[model samples]
Target chain A: LAKTTQPISMDSYEGQEVNITCSHNNIATNDYITWYQQFPSQGPRFIIQGYKTKVTNEVASLFIPADRKSSTLSLPRVSLSDTAVYYCLVGAPHRYGGATNKLIFGTGTLLAVQP
Target chain B: DAGVTQSPTHLIKTRGQQVTLRCSPKSGHDTVSWYQQALGQGPQFIFQYYEEEERQRGNFPDRFSGHQFPNYSSELNVNALLLGDSALYLCASSASWSGPQHFGDGTRLSIL
Candidate 1:
């Protein structure tokens, strides 16, 4: 598993675009970058995941560079409801066993959305 | 469809006590994993269970144990708990080990 470094906190106004970058300088070849959102008392929700280049979903977009040492989660037209803690995680995709499901979470970046 | 579900949303315990947290995996899911999240910190992996067996574990001590039933539901047990054991324990389940995991709101345990 690789260690991830990211901002402790970020702030953005409503309807603005917010990008949170996470750096995993020692990312492994089998590691994938996954982002999750957590509210005050709820479990973290999967936002987006990507290996390289970019991946987009209805809720967010994940961008990765060729080096794969980092990833950025982009949230477009954010709202007050989007205010939550965003976590970036790295893990190897499962091939045939259940051990690959273990994920290490860091002190994720807390995104505060201003109304 | 119902997602992952956990039990006893909030609990309070004292030192040297034992606590058990329950979890029901999502529909059609077979694998369950447990995590612990302290205040102002990220969730830490505890272990994962599949097919009624312990398949993988993290850096957690032996005091923390788990069991999986035939129905894929699981239970996390912490024995002789200490004050440091207080945290939000999360349960996540996936259709398979290769699938994306879905998490429950977690059981907040406060060990005094």
Candidate 2:
């Protein structure tokens, strides 16, 4: 398991771009960076995932450097609904090839999308 | 195509008592993991089950136990509960060992 560190909180206005960075200096070669968004009283929703470089989805984008030590989650055009805690998780492949998805979540970055 | 589902969205129990939380994994998922989340804090992993067996556990005490049924559903049991046990209990299900795990809304347990 790799530990990740992200900002405790970030503030952004609506229609602005918000980037949340996570540092995982000990990330392994088989590890992949994943981001999740959690709203109050709801379960965390998967936003984007990336092994390296950049991966864009319908909702967000994940940017990972070649070192694999850090990654950033970019959310374009933020809205009030985007106000939630964002979690950065480093997924390490297990011996079984990709069947154990156990995750450790630290206090995630609270992105407050203000109006 | 329903996602992961948990029963008894909310529960209340007194100290020294026991409570059981149930979870039905997403279709085709075979692994289930449980987590505890206190107020103003991120979720803490409790344990995980694969192939109907306990595979990994976190820092939770022996009081926190779980079982995975043949159908991939799971039950989280907490005995001798204390007020500190009052938190949201989360259940996540994954298709493989390293892929993304889907989660349920969670069961909010309040220990009195």
Winner by lDDT: 1
- Which regions of candidate 2 are displaced past 4 Å? A93-98
Across residues A1-115, which tens digit of lDDT does each residue of candidate 1 receive?
Answer: 8999999999999999999999999999988899999998899998888899999999999999999999999999999999999999988756375434688899999999998
Per-residue accuracy of model 2 over B28-90 as CA lDDT, tens digit each: 898899999898888888999988888889999999999988999999999999999999999
Q: Candidate 2 has what TM-score?
A: 0.96
lDDT of 2 at A61: 89
* Candidate 1 chain A weakest ten by summed lDDT: A92-101
User: Model 2 in CAPRI terms: which quality?
Assistant: medium
Output the lDDT of residue A104, model 1.
88
Residue-level lDDT for A22 in candidate 2: 96
Model 1 regions more than 4 Å off: none
lDDT, model 2, position B40: 84
Per-residue lDDT of candidate 1, residues B1-112 (tens digit): 9999999999999999999999999898888999999998899999998888888899999999999999999999999999999999999998765657789999999998
- Alpha-carbon local distance difference test for all models: 0.91, 0.89
Query: A-chain TM-score in candidate 1?
Result: 0.95
What clash count goes with each model? 0, 7
